[model samples]
Target chain A: MAKDNLLGGSLWDAYSNKVTTLMNNPQHQGEITEEEAAAHGNKLIVADFGAESCGDAVRLYWEINPETDVIENAKFKSFGCGTAIASSDVMTELCMGKTVDEAVKITNIDVEKALRDDPDTPAVPPQKMHCSVMAYDVIKKAAGLYKGVDAESFEEDIIVCECARVSLSTLQEVIRLNDLKTIEEITDYTKAGGFCKSCIKPGGHEEREYYLVDILADTRRQMDEEKMAAAADASMTGDFENMTLVQQIKAIDAVIDESVRQFLVMDGGNMEVIDIKNSDDNIDVYIRYLGACNGCASSTTGTLYAIESTLKEKLSQKIRVLPI
Target chain B: MQVYMDNNATTMTDPKVVEAMLPFFSERYGNPNSLHKFGTSVHLPLSKAIDQVYKGINASDGDDIVFTSCATEANNWVLQSVWIDNVLNSDKNHILTTEVEHPSILSTCKFLEEQGMKVTYLPVNDQGIVEAHTVRSFITDKTALVSIMWANNETGMIFPIQEIGEICKEKGVLFHTDGVQAVGKIPVDMQSVHVDFMSMSAHKFHGPKGIGALYIRDSQPLTPLFHGGEQMGGRRSGTLNVPGIIGMGRALELATENIEATMALIRSKRDRLEDALLEMLDDVMVVGERDNRTPNTILISVRGVEGEGMLWDLNNALIGASTGSACASEDLEANTVMLAIGADNELAHTGIRLSLSRFTTDEEVDYVIEAFTAAVKRLRAISSSYAKVGPSPGGEAQACDLLYHHDNDIVVKH
Candidate 1:
């Protein structure tokens, strides 16, 4: 059925004509037998993959000439929505006549783009993007079956930058060793996040478990802690009471940032130092709670004890913490 | 043969209604609030339209009907105002409703809960029917209002609103029903049922869009949702939509005039389609009982085939249908009615609703039955689960044969 013939109204307008055609009459919707492969001097592989989110599944059939390493024929049977069927059809079409290695390189983007009637318009809606991803997965499954290996083994390393083949450990080491701060700096040094940029953060074309933005932030925080630890060691000798108020505050802030802030932030709470005053014989530190810490009952008891004990151990033994 | 089976979403405006509304838009265009003769001339038709609405619902002359933009506005007005007058001003602070209500009521109840009101969303049974006893059990001393829909838009299961209304009356609590799907499809007599408020949308019946009415029982206290002009006697204040009012008035009149005869024809056609589909397909079940639901609705679930997949096949055949509620179609989530009826996750996604209207013909129904059956067979043959499970006990062997052939064919050769 063509797009103009659809009577379901604007909902059908979301799909391109090519997708609608393939969804209704998929060109490669069938299976290949082992006997057929043997007669042609080829190896047949069948692999099935299912999507847990929508219960959609697809089975890919490939007949590859092992001697030439070229895929002789490709077919697929999809058990999902129309988008999934169209995606699998285009994916199977793209796999034929290519080598086994080349077939594995066909990404979900290629499948989605091939299904589009025009180069600019999307073949399916955004919510249906996962169907093309499912198609891409089944190809890897079929290729893995023929190669006698796990489908996940195709990507042997955690390649953070797929375009440059940069691994996660390589990106982390580069950031730490060279003190790279911004994404532009990382891109300039290694070109890890330069192409595609999906490895930079979330909300991209592909979801990455380890992004360059997070890796850089973690590495920089470790470097800051290392520097703070060195400073603490140098200042630990009995210079607490001899230091001026501003100097003492700065030293306390550094210790608090290293020891207390992370735990407070994890629990959706935080506090800031208001003032430091000398009350009679005791040095008193006044603190105000922010966010969830403001009305918490434990801010008076357990939290107060932790803050007072941390200040006593890190800075001056005579210091007392009070919440106002 | 472009068949439309998504009538619960909206209906086509009757040509008669269009003819009635044409004069108000051009020739008799006047603000009803003005004191001029042109404005005064509009009052006769406006009041006649109001009378038609009152007669359509069998309401007494003492009852009040305020026209709103749509049922969404009418529903919001009742819920929000009840929250202010009963919950905020008085000691009553609890609201009781069902889990399978339209989003207009459920979302408003959720908003009220966030504003410190206690709400209990009563669950429905496996048949998607909420028992009146469940309503009686959930009501407390602090219960302010019991809001529920007269008929579900997805399953078309008519709730026991009459019994539930009596329970609320006995308990001295206010009751409101969202009648967006029930007004013209079923008999709604306000003189018999003891409801304090009811929301109605004209488009759900054959009227034009952008017009609806909220029925308020005589002398019931309600905080005005809008505060401006004295239109609608200060209940809802805006310059009257004269054309929409005229269309709704005439639409409701035609809808109820031969409703029993028209609905009987629609019911027979709906039943023929439903029965034929159930007999032809395997692993298919209707969501609710035929007799308990409205006259023209069938929510069927086909195992091993997705709702969107079936919709695509139907659309390719020039048929228009919906998967579950049309409002939640964009998210592709499982149907809320199915989930509330204790269907598993997969079955929830398989439920498709096909609603009929007065405009539906026997030919359209027959065409849908044939098209839907063919779609099911084709979809099931390609379904991965069907291939694995084979078929249900005593299932049609032809469908299994098709599946077997589809799985074993050597279509692509080296």
Candidate 2:
């Protein structure tokens, strides 16, 4: 969220479109039945997790093929808030075809990202990051049940700053959530780079999974990629489909040639595009044929196919031509 | 009108203290270090202010009082001076403190440890009381200083400071106490206790803010942490805050006048609030109830309700209180003082400190009791943790437990 959220509603505006959709009606929220497990010839894994601070609990179910280590099916029963339900639903969806080891590597960031419409906006606000964390923890719990190991045994990642007690994931989340571009802002928020001065960069502190400087650079790159992805989506030809009829005709006129107009105007006839309409499989471009071309027979056979093929090749594959 | 009870965090500066400081701000503004009559005029009053501050702390009425910016500064100076003295003397280098001490002591000890000084942070009992014998046992030839607090800022548990001071005197070790909470409200007689160094703050007891003093015994070998031009015979070198020092002197003098009657009145109100809490609220844990505390402080923990949330409700009702310690409450971790007293995380999260001064009255007490009762009801009614077993009805006032658990799912209540 921005400082003032020039957009109204801070928490609501921070949520991505996909999170709002899933939070309203979660698609993959249910318990995996024993019969479904038997039919797939896979073992059932049930994992229950509770957040110690907030008393929110979630039970995740995964049916996996033991030999292939693939999650044949996934479902969840969430006894938490709407954010947790959305995050759990997305986590189960992400685990549907992933192996146990592969699922184990999916962090809370991955779960939050999966629920985001795009990578630019977060699925939930910074405070609700813990719900996604619960989602991530339950995946590890389910995987641990299948592998016959403790979920806590997987916490061997290098912790960066011990003085301020900032871990690697916390710094990454702060960096990603606020779009932090500098190391000093990281210190101002998380106090990681403030203390011991060791974790600011590799030279100051002991070696770790994430140096503060490195997280800033990686997050900045991710932010740039997000901007470019949004730009790429807006600039594609689908942009024409969302335009008004007048704007669409103007867009189609920009692609036509003056020589093509001259070809029609040569025999005391002229064609001018009036409106464009789109249907399921066709785009009907209406034209006002002037100067005797309205009554010419060749206008239908020759000029019709030429305009139709040109529009289909230039704008979209679904385009068609009609003159009225 | 708002009834302020969070004097442990700070106080409403006494009007008298403010009146005394008014002239020094502009009318009598002269650098105490000047040579002219403007500077020399404040010399006698500066001596008088130091004398009053000395009297307030039971020190010999003289210039042994080194004024600092605040209690945290005074604390840091005392500890750092000991460390620096040890560096020069080439003798004992160990310091002993407790786990429940304010961060001014604990964080300084940590910084000293990073510089290769050994610190022993002794734990406290379930009631947040530290026996004097624990400090006695920890003291050795290598121990140069023992820094304890006169009373805890969070729980208001008065430590056995006089007893520990005697033991330190017998062992030939210097004892320094951060007496920020205890100085003005409680009696202090240097003639009785053998405390070698003590720290005091002005604002904790209805004085002005941004001024504090540290008492150093006349003949103790000390090294100043700051080195500058002559100030306090070069013990602490900085330009004197003339107005703040004058206000502190008058505030301490006013706080100590007819002290027994004031203490009695404060004790009644504090005790009455504690009784009302036990009678009007359910699952209340009063920290340090078994131990001797100062008369004006009460620490209570309500089950299934947050300490900060309780404070917000109190603020809404025109009441003032603190949770755990206001200075360190910005961090979301459980209160260290509560945890040191064997409180579990959830219990520690619900700790609120209500401190009173002589300025508090009977009407404020009654209003606070009613406000607190309603706030606990309001918070508990909405708490999810309280949903299973809602608040038990208020029972008759009894000896409240040192700790209480509301449900069986979590048993580490105390």
Best by DockQ: 1
Superposed by TM-score, candidate 1 places the C-alpha of residue B28 at a distance from the truth, in angstroms, of 1.4
Q: Put down candidate 2 lDDT per residue, A108-157, tens digits, no spaces.
A: 77887888887787676654555676688778777777777777666565
Clashes per candidate, residues 3 or more apart or on different chains = 0, 0
**Interface RMSD of the candidates, in order:** 11.8, 14.3
DockQ, all models: 0.13, 0.02
TM-scores for every candidate against the unseen true structure: 0.74, 0.60
The residue pairs in collision within model 1 are none
CAPRI grade of model 2:
incorrect
lDDT by residue for model 2 (B192-240), tens: 7888888889998889999998887864657886679878778788899
- What does the i-RMS of model 2 come to? 14.3
Misplaced by over 4 Å in model 1 are A1-11, A33-44, A51-55, A64-71, A98-102, A143-149, A155-324, B325-328, B388-414
